[model samples]
Target: METTGTRRSLAWLVGIWALTRVVLLLFVFKVYAFPGPDVTSDVSVIYQGWYEVLRTGTFPLDDVTWQYPPAAALAILSPALVFWLDYTSAFFVLCFAADLVVLLLLLYAGLRSGRTSRGAWVWVVGVPLLGPTVYARYDVMVTGVAVAALLAGARYPRVMGALTAFGAMLKVWPVLLLVAARRRGSWVWAALTAGVLAALFALAMPGAFAFLTFQRDRGTEVESLGALVFHVARQYGWDGQVLLNYGSVEFLGPYVDVVSTAALVLSGLAFGWLLVWRLRARSFHVHTLADGAFVAVLMFVTTSRVISPQYMVWLVGLAAVCLCFRESRMGVPVGLVLVASFVTVLEFPVWFSHVVASDGLGVTLLFLRNGLLILAALLAARELWRSTVPLPTPPPVPTESPRLRETSLPS
Candidate 1:
C-alpha cells in the first residue's frame, strides 16, 4: 500500500538513523573518545556492578546509587540476552535496538493516512542532537516503550494502557501518557497491569521496593533549574559543597534543602495544574493523547529537582509522537526541546567540569537550557489549554449598533 515517494522517504529516514547510530556506537564503544568524563563508565562500571547483584536474585540493597524502581532491574539485566558480547557492548546494542524500534514505530504511524513523516524526522534529528548520551543511558529504552504506548493510544486503548503501565514501571514518567485518555478500558487495564507487576516484583525479589526510600535526603542537582541559585551564590562566597550523592552530583550544603523543597513544591503545582486541565478540557481529538502526554512530561521535567541529560530523550520521544498527528500543535515546544537538547550535551559530558565548578560557561548553559524548557512549558500549556478548554465564545460581537437595530435597519 506504500507509494513510491513514501518508500523513498522511509528509506531515507532509515539511512539517517543508521548513519547517526553508527557514530553513537563508535563513541560508546570507545573507538573514539567523547569529551570530558567518560559517559560509558556508568554502563561499564555502575550498571555492570548492579547486574552482578541483580543476577543473584536480589536488588543492590546496600548501594544508595541503586535508586530506580524494581522493573529497572530488567533493563540492567537485559544485556544477558546477548551473551556473545561484553556487558557494555550488549547494553549499547540493546539501546541501539530500542532506538531503531522507536524510529520504526514513528515511520509506521507517520506514513499512515492523515499522518505526517515530520514525526519520524523529529526522532531522527532529535536523538543525535543529544549526542552519544542518547545510547549511554537506559532512558532511551524506557522512551521506546513510551512512544509505543502513545502511538497505540488512538486505536487500541487497552494495549496503550498495558504498555503505559509497563513503561511506568520501567521509569515513572510514562504514566503521564494517559492524561487525555477517555476510554475506561485504558484506565482499567493500566490499574490491573500495574497492580500485577507490583505484586510480582514484591514477591520475587527482596528490596524490590527499596528504591522508594532511597531519595529521602537528596540535594538539588547542579543541572536543575533550582541549582542556578547555588551556581550564582558560589560566586559570592556561599559555602556549599558539590558532592556525588544519590548517584548524581548535587549541591550539599547551606540552603540546598530549601532549593530542593522549592523544586518539589513546583512539581506539586504542576500536578495540580494538570489535574485542572484534565477536568476542564472539553475538546478531544485523536492527537490530544500525544499532545497531553507531551505537555504533562514537560511540566514535570522542567520543575523536577534533577534534569539529567538523558531526560531529553523522554521529551524528544514524546515530541515525536505529537508530531505524528497533523492535528497536534506542539511544533514550537518540540523545536525548543530540540534546541535545549543540544545545550544539554554541552552542559554535561562536554564541559561538565565547568558545571561542577559553577563557572561562567556552566551557568550560561544551564540558564539557556532551563530557560528554553520553562518557555516551552509555558507555551505548550497555553496551546493545550486554548485548544481543548474552549474560549468564552468571545462575548458574541454585535453585527450592528443597538440604535440601528431599534430603527429596524437589520436585514
Candidate 2:
C-alpha cells in the first residue's frame, strides 16, 4: 500500500509537471505562429519535413541537418500514425506519450525494487525542471530506451542489448549503456544485436553512412563547455566569429579548429577513464551499473563539443534510474544536475540573446550551469569508484590444528 506521504508527493509532482507543460506548450504555439531562426527550428516544420521525406519512401540523407542515424527514421515517421491531426499537434502528442512511458517505467521499477521512492521522485521532478526542451526535441525518446535498457540489464541482458541498440540507432549516445551489463554474455548479446541492426539499416537505407561524414566535419557548438573558454576569450579581443553551422551555433575563425580538436582529445581521455574504471571495478550491482552509466554519459556530454540544451534529458533520465536502487547514494549529485538543467533553460530560451552576445549575465549563467555539471560529474565518479571497489577481505583468522586442541585438552 502507498503511504500518505507518497500519495501527497505524487499529487504535487503531477500537478507541477502538468502546469509547466501547459505553459511551455502555450509558449511553443505562440512561437510557431511567428517562428524564429534557432538551433532547434520550429518543431512542426522540422518533423513535418522529415515525415514528408519518409512518406516518399526515401530517407532524409540528402538534408545536411539530418545528422541522426537511420533508426531515427522511425520516430520521424511515428507522428504520422495520427495523420488526421496536423503535424505539430501529432508530434507534440507523440512526444507527450513518450514522456509518460518513461515516467511509468521509472515508477514501476522503483516500486518493484521494494526500496526507496527516490527514483520516481527524481523522474517526477527532474523531467519537468528541464522545461519545454523535454518535449520540444526527440531526445526524450532516446532517454526512454536508455531507461528501459538499464532496468532490464541484469535480468535480461539480451533484451537490454536490443533496446540499447535500437536507441543508438536513434542517437549514437545510447550505445554507451551497453557498458553497464554485468554478464559476459551480455556483451556478446549487445554487440550482436547492435551489429545486426546496423547491417539491416545499411541494407535498407541508401546513405546509411552519411551521418558519420557529416559528424566528422562539424565544428564546436557555441554552447559546449569548451566553447565557454572562447566566450571568455572574446573579452580579450579574440577574433573568432559565431555563426549557425550544422544546425548549431559554432565558433568559426582562427584557432577554432584547435579548440575542437582539444574537445575530441578530452573525449578520448574520458573513454579511457571509463575503461580503467570498468577493469578495476569489483562490484557489479544494478545500482552500481546505473551510477557508472551516468558517470560515463556525464563525461561524454561535458567533454563533447556540442552540449545542447535538450541533452540534459539524457542525464536526467539516467540520474533517475540511478536513484531507483536503494544502494545509490547520489542525492547530492542528482540535486546538482537538477539545478544545472534549470540553468540550461534560462541560458537558452530566456536569456539566449545575452548568450549570443557573450555578455556578463550570459557568461555567468553558463559558468554556474557548467560548474554544477562538473561538480556532479566529479561527485558521481567518486561515488561509483568507492562503491565498486570491493572492500578488502581481512586475512583469515589462523585456525588452531586438531592436534593442538587434543594436546591442550585436560588429561
Candidate 3:
C-alpha cells in the first residue's frame, strides 16, 4: 500500500511535468515566439549550400558551406520538395515525426520486454518541453532511425539493422552499435547495412565517392571537455587547426595534441576490446548491447572535438530505454545526462558569448554546469560498474516456445 501511494505520487509529478511542458510548447509557438532566425542559424543556412549542388547535379566539397555527407543532404533536401524554401516549418514537421518514431520504437521495445506499459511510460515522458528536435536541426531524423534500430534489438534485430543503416546515412554513430551486437547475428545484417548505405550514398549524390574522400581531409572544432584543451591552447597563445587526416585537432601543443591523440586511440581500442570480449564470450543479450551503446556515447561525448546539445536527445532516449526495461539502473544516468545536456547548450550559446561580452558570472555558471556534468558522468560510471558486476539478472523473457533465444535480453 505504501509503494502504491508512492507510485501514485510519482505519477502525479510526471503528469505535472508533462502539463507544464505542453504549456511551455504553446508559449514557444504563440507567446514566446520561436524568434525564428537571423542569418546566423537560419533555416536556409541548414540546407544553405546543398541546394546549389543539387541544382548543378554535383556534390559539395572542400568545406564549401561545410557540406555534409551525401546521405545527410538527401534528408535535408527531401522535405524541400514539399515545403520548398520553408525549411523552418518543415523542420518542425520533421521533429514532430521524430517524436512519433521514438514513441513507436519505445512501444516496440516494451512489447519485446513483455512490459508494454513500461515502454509507454518511457515514450510519453522522454520528450521535452522544447517541442521536437527538428525544430532547430534535422539530426532528429537520424536519431529516430538509430534509436529504433537499437531498441528493436529486443524483437527484430534485422529490422533494427535496416533502420540503423538508414540512420548511419544521416549520421554515422548508429553503425557502432554493431560492435556491441557481435554476439548475435548482427555481423551478417551489418554487412547488408553497409551495402545499402554505400548504394544509397552513391545513388543520392553523383559525387559520393569524391565526398567520402573529401571528408577525410576535414576535422572537428573543440567542444565538450575537449574544449578544455582548446581553452588551454588559447591561454598559452596557440593557433588551433583541425587535422582531419588524423580525425583530431592540430596546431596546438604538439605534445598535448599527441597525448590527446593517444587518449583518443586508447578509447577506440577499449571499445573494440569490449566488442571482442562480448563476441568471444558469446554473450548476446539486449541489455548488453544497450549498455555498450551507453559506454560508446560517453566516449564520444568525452572525446569528440565537437559536442552539440541535440546529441543529448540520443543519450536521454537511450537512458529512458534503459529505465523502461529496468536495465542497468538507468535512472542514475538519465539524471546525469539531463544535466549534461542542458549545460552543454548553456555553455556554448550562452556563456561563450557572454564571455566575449566580458560577463564573468556567465562564464562561472557555465563552468559550474560543466563540473556538474563531469561529476554526474563520474557517479553514473561508478554506478554502472557496480551494476554490471554480479548484478542480479532480470527474469527470463516469456515466449511461445519458452526456449532460450540467441538474442535473449535477461528479463
Per-residue lDDT over 372-402 for candidate 2, one digit per residue giving the tens place of the 0 to 100 score: 9989988988888888877678999999999
Clashing pairs in 1: none
Please, what are the lDDT tens digits per residue for candidate 1 over residues 136-185?
89999999999999998888999999999999889888999998999988
Q: Which window of 10 residues has the lowest lDDT sum in candidate 1? A: 390-399
User: Which candidate leads the pack in TM-score?
Assistant: 1
Q: Looking at candidate 1, what is the lDDT of residue 168?
A: 89
How do the predictions measure up, each by TM-score?
A: 0.95, 0.90, 0.72
Model 3 is weakest, by summed lDDT over 10 consecutive residues, at 33-42
- Off by more than 4 A, model 1: 394-411
Off by over 4 Å in 2: 31-40, 391-411
**Positional deviation of 47 in candidate 1, in angstroms?**
0.7
Candidates arranged by lDDT, highest first: 1, 2, 3
Q: After superposition, how far is residue 260 of candidate 3 from its true place, in Å?
A: 5.7
Cα misplacement distance, residue 49 of candidate 2 (Å)? 2.0
